[model samples]
Target chain A: MPDKTAPDAARRSQRSRQAICEAALSLVGETGYDKLTIEGIAARAGVGKQTIYRWWPSKGAVLLDAFTETMEAGEGTLPDTGDLATDLKAVLRATVDEFNDPAFQAPYRALYVAMVNDSEVSAGFTSKVMEPGTQAYVDRIRAAQDAGEVSEDIDPRLAAELILGPFAQRWLLRSQPLTHEFADSLVDMALTGLRPRNPRA
Target chain B: MPDKTAPDAARRSQRSRQAICEAALSLVGETGYDKLTIEGIAARAGVGKQTIYRWWPSKGAVLLDAFTETMEAGEGTLPDTGDLATDLKAVLRATVDEFNDPAFQAPYRALYVAMVNDSEVSAGFTSKVMEPGTQAYVDRIRAAQDAGEVSEDIDPRLAAELILGPFAQRWLLRSQPLTHEFADSLVDMALTGLRPRNPRA
Candidate 1:
């Protein structure tokens, strides 16, 4: 336990936690999740193994925390610029850019591999990453509904899925190249739809 | 290599291949992809390790072959019942049913986990599973276009992703409960779109 009277000690503890999380992220990227260990993280962070153990239960927990920290460091919500299509496209294009970046690929893939096999890890990811990210889109859709740009009949949750799911599918499967054009097409197809419009009822 | 003149030897080789694939699938279900090995599959299948080595270079290859065999045992095309929405819903519902089955959960998750981490495994999966499956939907969309049910201006490939991507995302992320209702909603959303229809030109 940290002493409440010692401000310097609390700051040192916070610094140690950040170092450990960063160490875990970089180590997983270098060695992959299968070989990452608490000892390696502690050694790299210049902290004791007991320090890691006191904070996180397992390596998966540490990685989850690391991923969460990265996400929180970004803007916490989806853009709501009044036009749903423009805002969603901008967000998705940025996501495509992130997915295409070599610097982020290894660590993200390692975390995803861990999430696939372990239910506990999967649940942690859902809570920390998926839920909040999805909620931001849902909020944007709701804002569109209020502005009369979107139909009231559309379920905001499902609308969020329609906007976000294609990107996740293409990225996870590596089935095709992820491009800005692809993001724009998803927004267009999702908004206007696949069926031709009839001007006359 | 089996003697071409010996029908009995050829039949025996076919049986051995089947046995090995089955063993690989069941072993992955029991112990997961991380713990699976060629030796374990050979032992479980009652074949020598040399037999497995002769046909496959690694455990990932063996699992890919196993998954391919499973997919081949089913009907090889998406349904084309003239109504694109109905047909897409039917296909997505069956996929959701397969995902929810306890019998299929372990082996499928193992294959997916392998796909995410290894580019070779992922490429095999794309060729063996993802591409063929997406092509089936694309063909049906084209059929719908010819029949005047869909817009010719719409990109068939992106339409397929819009149809299939939601199911893949929910299944992979476990973000929400995947239900038949969700499948139907996706079909509707992908068809009519999110914007309210304007009746007057």
Candidate 2:
């Protein structure tokens, strides 16, 4: 779909760009990220490699674009109803669902492979992709802290980590099955917690 | 060092094997894992690639062996004084130190790359290496649950994830500076509490 805000010429450009991203995603799903090439995406999309290079510098960048688009379509804005625990659980449950989806998982695995292999790609993914994605949690945690919902002694940054870190570990590391049960349990443990003595105090 | 428990002939073999493992670590550090080859390790260790191939099926396996050996030397055992909070903190803090160390980080990055690329390597690493390493935590979490230290409602597996997931996230994702303080905070948060209402009840 073209960006509706654009004029006809700009709409055509947007459509072409969207096609290129779709091609990137398709090929990555088919070939895995390591075998995926810019040439292949361009060929699939009926565009030149120069067309892709004109917008994105590397295959990793193109994949990152595709990931962000899919991500927006799936887990866009997190809820903020002033109930921090409920809100966090909802967002994390969505994440569990996303990681379970093959459309997201395969390409994501490829991105991780690319990130660890190339420092430049890693930096781009972190700055352009991850840092922005994390802001929602950071904002929510800060809000909770300010509202006295979360303890003032808690570091919002670390609090955010407590929520998302385990998600990343389970999903990215493939350490265990990503389940809604697991996600809810994380929120449950985080809120009520494991301490016999209320370790927070 | 040779495995002291081995007989004289086996002791000599162990010493030779240790040299090869050391060579694998040194080369992985110097050349990075991608460029590391069995032939290169053999040449450095003054053995044939057949020697490496004899004991381990792949370079990744050899690397895992080296990782396990190094890990045993560094941490020996997680302090298991039956105090879950203290024991978890100590283990996680050591992990922070391990990830921060160049020796572990380089090979671990290599292992992660290898795991993504090869199913066989992934299986071996996950089952043989990760599973065993994580069993300690799983056992401990179960023990805590049985002792009524942790809430009975909590899934020990999920609880284990909650404890180590953040540590893995900070270390593996390269999201933030992994520190002892961060490790302590995770344990503190897990034990003391996060929610005012105690979601578990």
Candidate 3:
């Protein structure tokens, strides 16, 4: 039989890890990335700074882990209801809502900015967050193509970018408001090209 | 006659301003933004630290001015060769080249990261760089619509985003290569809707 002490210790370590992730997210959201510290995260989580340092190399790694855990816990495949435009719009609209959430804005932007300058941070974010996220959309687009909705000539990965790119750009630049209406427009334009549909054809 | 001394002073000040902007760009390119300092820029430009501080509030502002001047000096309306696809592809391919250029990468990423946390930097960049750049595309799209190549029902601004957004996303996330081939695919997919063209329509 497995040792009872081993199981108990594993549980405690897991609990500590979760608490540290929560604290890192909370502190970055409240004070932003520049002011965040390992000590502050430790104090908030009631763990020693040594514990944090032992588990993670830096505050950026802690935050990346926090975001990755939070995302994975709630991650679901993109919805597919046979109707391509309807499904894509649902996903984009939900994303817009997430981007606008007060709890998500500061911490998300903090990680985003960090990744811009830090190669390690960028690599971690790309592997842990971006790849999985892009894969979901790619799967959805492939399904649509199989259903005879999207053209076979299109690359599903690039098609996914066409659908998702506008929202990312607008959000990053704050060029304009991200509304459900904007999401709908993107889905429509992406599905139906800029060429005027030939009514008589 | 106008005071010759006043004109001479104005010429000297203009020369100093150009030197400072050039120095700021070159230093940021070589050392990256984190190591850049006003004193460094002044020393490189052969000007006093007081001159840099007197003109700009922060390094971010100085960088913004430098970028804006560089872009404006070369700013031209997007080409409208009547073939929308060819024109857009040319513009995007050139952008791909610019993004991949060694000299453009570090300082551009620096300003991009700075704008994430600094609202003042964001506003300055939006007004000075983004707005003018976007407008060029908007004008080209408008011209295309008038020429009957694109659908009149399309919003020039939104359509512009559809074409530009994918490039921005791929570049920022570093998810894939931003090649001329990728630029061509974006134009093709964007021009022809994802739906397979009805051959007998």
Q: Return the top candidate by TM-score.
A: 1
Q: Report RMSD (Å) for each prediction in the order shown.
A: 3.2, 6.0, 3.0
lDDT of each: 0.86, 0.77, 0.86
Clashes of each: 0, 3, 1
TM-score for candidate 3, please give it.
0.89
Stretches of candidate 1 off by over 4 Å are A1-16, A35-57, A199-201, B1-16, B47-54, B199-201
Model 3 off-target regions past 4 Å?
A1-16, A37-51, A72-74, A199-201, B1-20, B34-51, B72-74, B199-201
Candidate 2, CAPRI quality class derived from DockQ: acceptable
Clashing residue pairs in candidate 1 (N, C-alpha, C atoms within 3 angstroms): none
On lDDT, the stronger of 1 and 2 is 1
Superposed by TM-score, candidate 1 places the C-alpha of residue A126 at a distance from the truth, in angstroms, of: 0.6
TM-score of chain A of each: 0.88, 0.82, 0.90
Model 3 chain B scores worst on lDDT over the 10 consecutive residues at: B67-76
lDDT of 2 by residue, B1-201 (tens): 877565887877898799998998888888865578889999999988898888988787788787667755333235568788888988888788878988778888877777775567777777766767677787888788787788766777767777777787666567678998888888988776665544344
Clashing pairs in 2: A198-B192, A199-B192, A200-B192
How does model 2 fare in lDDT?
Answer: 0.77
Pick the DockQ winner: 1
